[model samples]
Target: MFKHSKFAAVAILAISAYHGAAFAQDAADPVVAKVGGVEVHQSELTLAMTGLDPQLANLPEEQKRVAALSAIIDVKLLAADANKEGLQNDETFKQRVAYLTDRELHNAYFKKHVVDSVTPEEVKARYEKEIAAIEPQEEVHARHILVKTQQEAKDVIVALDGGKDFVELAKEKSTDPNKSEGGDLGYFTKGRMVPEFETAAFALEKGTYSKEPVQTQFGFHVIKVEDKRKQAPPTLEQVQDQVRQLVMRDKYVKLLEDAKAESTVEIEDPALKKAYEEVNKQQADQKPQQQ
Candidate 1:
């Protein structure tokens, strides 16, 4: 019962798009199955395949086709029986059909206006604006010698001060996996490390190691700062998809706000109405208009 309901919901969601798409080709979608004198065409089978539950979607391609065909056959048989019983004429079914039709139309409009309307130039502009707003942060390229005991960390610091190579000492004394690379942590900003370690590392000048061991949850660290510089912004290609989503969201919110302003929305329950208003208020507070 639950499975059937899920498929019905998916089919309803696809209805408008399917209808618009069905006219694109003049070639016939041959009848693949029949039930109670009702024929199921290839187009209907394709819709059924598109609407399969995610769990069933993972099946082999041929098996997926067979499963979709089976589901469509069942739907046809049950629909024919319902029609025979005049269930199609029932008021409840009529109301449901109306709601499903409106929902599908809503999806079609959203696809056309929000999804299709987004352009590459708009995404790039949004990315540039967002990137410009980010404050530059200093990042450090550092290495460390991590040891189980503070005394061990102190010994490593002594090794550094005595002009022993940090990388060799790290490989010999440190327990961290990066010890093989001389405990190289590459470049990172302050928030990336624990408070104690970050404070100690950031306090050091380039080319200096901590004279004393710094303790943290990971044990003790003999820290050094190899270099420090401003962090770089991500490449456009790396953030293009995310920026496109931001563009879509902004468009959707504007459409909803305009629609809400023109329409009457009344919640009969006072508590539910209050909750709805609060949600809208929170959304408004969280994101500023992109422009």
Candidate 2:
């Protein structure tokens, strides 16, 4: 329910260090409105679009701008009145303003030094390194016909032996939801299926069906192996975003490490200091899932 005035000379954008605020500060930031000679820039309105009421995220674009404009106008009007009342000289207000300004500067620095510094080449190289580190694993491409009883499974094998199309038989007879897709299980590595099903599916020769019904907790299954191959590593396109984050996280940790080594971080509270050290140590010892 909170609105855009929260960002107009008020709270700093807390999201990604208010990344858009940097753009708002550019020269020739088009002036949309003015109050007492103070012009509201396009960048400020853009920040309000996001930092304002989060619920406005779902609103249409024009509505969001209108809402942001209204909020900016309200704040400017009250701000002018508050100036007449000499509220700007209040000590607490000045301290709060100073703190918010410092926080904004920190965000601007982070945006420049960390977020924007990561390159596409860096992300791709990291992704390649991660993929290279993963050991090759075997995978199987198979299909199955699940039925409730042993007799039904045997009948399925008999039909396969009789040259009945496995996919069509599965569509007509299988109990699994994938029956519609001719019971195709696609490709899977070991441990993805029940022990009995895995054993039966993996043992069959390519382009062959299980000669016997395989029993598992789920039910009786007649399996067919379509092919077998080493499981492929995920493509960069499939995991590029995750790899980018990994790179950024690593860069940020390095920055912190260098900064900490150069400065004295004093913790006045003993217990809090211990906890802080423990958290930092844990982070240092941890490995990202990309590895």
Candidate 3:
């Protein structure tokens, strides 16, 4: 039964593809597969598979080919029916085709000029330059006891002063979700925490808890700074793929900028003209802010 089902599935796909090419001239291409006097081509199958799910791409070569052939046949069958009804002449169909064609062209150009041109050496150089420019920033490992009120936070700090284990107190009393992990926040750089909490946490010495309850928008917190160290930049192997993406994006932006500068550009619509000017002005203003 299973073998019959499989053969039926393959037969249906071949038939669909054959019917899809029914409108095309029989003399156009000998590559076409004929089903009931209809034609299907290899290109149709290839294009069909290009849009398949990513997981399908991982299938064994034979299975992938079979799936692609099936999908192409289905697409051809639908296309033939649509043509028969003259749906191809519809305004909506024309617009959809135009949009899809333009998007595909843009993607093809980006892949050819930017993505394909990016080399490993370029990515490595960009990463090296970025590492050189980065200033050593301090990071801290800390823990906190969160409470609903200032009084509750104050009591927690008092317990800390009397030699109670910060983690034990946090587990028993803290309202924050991290209480289960003994309030360990792991390591983080400055500006990651709220200003009030950051200020108190950064000022504390290693192994010392905040003497007072620190008030913030979340609530009151009793913080203990566990350690402080210089932040380490990511190693090349750790972020090689990310570095490649950054380099490619930078190249893509340059390509577009160069194209725009070299082109004869015009905006015929008044609303679009005004919007374009505003965007240009905003971008120009941002340059000085960065400086």
Clashes of each: 0, 0, 0
What is the per-residue lDDT of model 1 for residues 177-267, given as tens digits with 9 covering 90 to 100?
9999999999999799999999999999998999999999999999989999999999899989999998999999989989999999999
Error of 1 at 100 (Å): 1.0
Ranked by TM-score, the better of candidates 1 and 3 is: 1
Per-residue lDDT tens digits for candidate 2, residues 110-184, read 778788999999999999999988998888999999999999999988889999999999999999999999999
Lowest lDDT block of 10, candidate 3: 282-291
Clashing pairs in 1: none
- Global CA lDDT computed for model 1: 0.91
Write the number of the candidate with greater TM-score, choosing between 1 and 2: 1
Q: Which residue runs of candidate 1 sit more than 4 Å off their true CA positions?
A: 1-28
lDDT of 3 by residue, 143-192 (tens): 99999998898888778888899999989999999899999999999889
Clashes in predicted model 1: 0
- Assess candidate 3 and give its TM-score to the true structure: 0.60
Q: Judged by TM-score, which candidate is best?
A: 1
| Best first by lDDT, ranked | 1, 2, 3
